[model samples]
Target: MVYFNERDLCYNSIYPHNNSWTMSRIELDACAECDLLLTPARPAVGDKARCPRCGYLLQRPRKQSVARTFALSLTGLILILPANLLPLVGIKVLGNTRDGTLWSGVLTLYREDMWAIAILVFLSSILVPLINIVLSVLVSGHLYFRRPNRYLPYWMRWLQHLEEWAMLEVYMLGIIVACVKLASMADLRFGFGLYAFIALLIVNALLASCLDPYLFWRRIEQLQHNHRHEN
Candidate 1:
């Protein structure tokens, strides 16, 4: 079962190679319930538990992923509002002071004709976190309510795919780089937002660790079967 979300609306894989080709395709399996397309994993014991199709776990939901994703998502959400509202970094040189927020950096990139970089920054730093929080809530609610949707499995799979692109740690690295360069030029002040962003980064990592696409997909199939009998 795949839950209804933007995450379920697509699929694309990028293979590793010197001249790798990108395979962009939306999975279209018939909906058993809730109009979702479920793509099952080839189950195998041991180290290769990941789905060959999309690299999701072939087994069930990992308990560790559940705990980590939930904890991180909750904490990240809490920190998110403040991370945007508070000043990220402040710089003072020659008695003149300047402050930078998340938007400031994006805008700077935009003005420089670095639209691609700006978009990447926007997606990773802003959009991806929001999607992760929203998807986690929906996926968790579906599991908790046990109200299986046909699309649930597909959503779970796609969510994991989306999760990979939401690299909060990478964003943090960029921030650290910027801070180092800024510090060499002037006296810099780190603010609450910086701490919040760091916390968010840890939260994102935890969420990824806790998520298991396989568990959700299996649950979805069972749900569809159960619903058929009821009808």
Candidate 2:
């Protein structure tokens, strides 16, 4: 039997042992928000777990999470090059036509001696997004194929931390703001790159939705444990 202590914020499990009962604390799960120790009850498919004290979402398992994430991440990778290299928008001001690509934007900032802003934009917009997609593919692909990699834990850690730095949505918002500002002054034309960029953003969002960090961590642990036993 398992019971929770509301005052101490701990879950204790009791087991029968030779005409007696042994009580032990279960530390398998911890609430990410309130730091409450818990032995989480497994929720059924499409169900979720929440922290009792803080009301923070603890876990929500998705069906075929690994396969879904891998597919979306791979699609994002394929879309990224065109999203960055091709012209995103074209503008005509008094017969002077100008096309803007993501790479060109960063280079323009650098050429204007705004090196710091250029670097920041480059990292947040282009580099970080690419890294996140690649890492997602690597992690999900390995798991989907049942491959036990020693570096899986490290990859997952970096993926989670770097998620905050990938500002694709922010960049998209900036693009929208620029378009709105430029509409009155110039004739704006959307390009193929804009469509690809939008698709990439959608795919990234889907990938994030399909990934279950807790499930991935548990699977990784099981994989490594099984590998150790086999060896």
lDDT (Cα, 0-100) at 219 in candidate 2: 82
Native RMSD of candidate 2 (Å): 4.6
The 0-to-1 C-alpha lDDT of every candidate, in the order given, reads: 0.66, 0.85
lDDT of 2 by residue, 107-163 (tens): 999999999999999999999999999999999998999899999999999999999
Q: Judge candidate 1 at residue 43 and give its lDDT.
A: 34
Model 2 has an lDDT value of 0.85
Number of the predicted model whose TM-score against the real structure is largest = 2
User: What are the runs in model 1 whose C-alpha is more than 4 Å off?
Assistant: 1-61, 64-68
Residue 206 C-alpha lDDT in model 2: 87
Predicted candidate 1 versus true structure: per-residue lDDT over 143-174, tens digit per residue: 66667676776667767778678777777777
The clash count for each model shown is: 15, 0
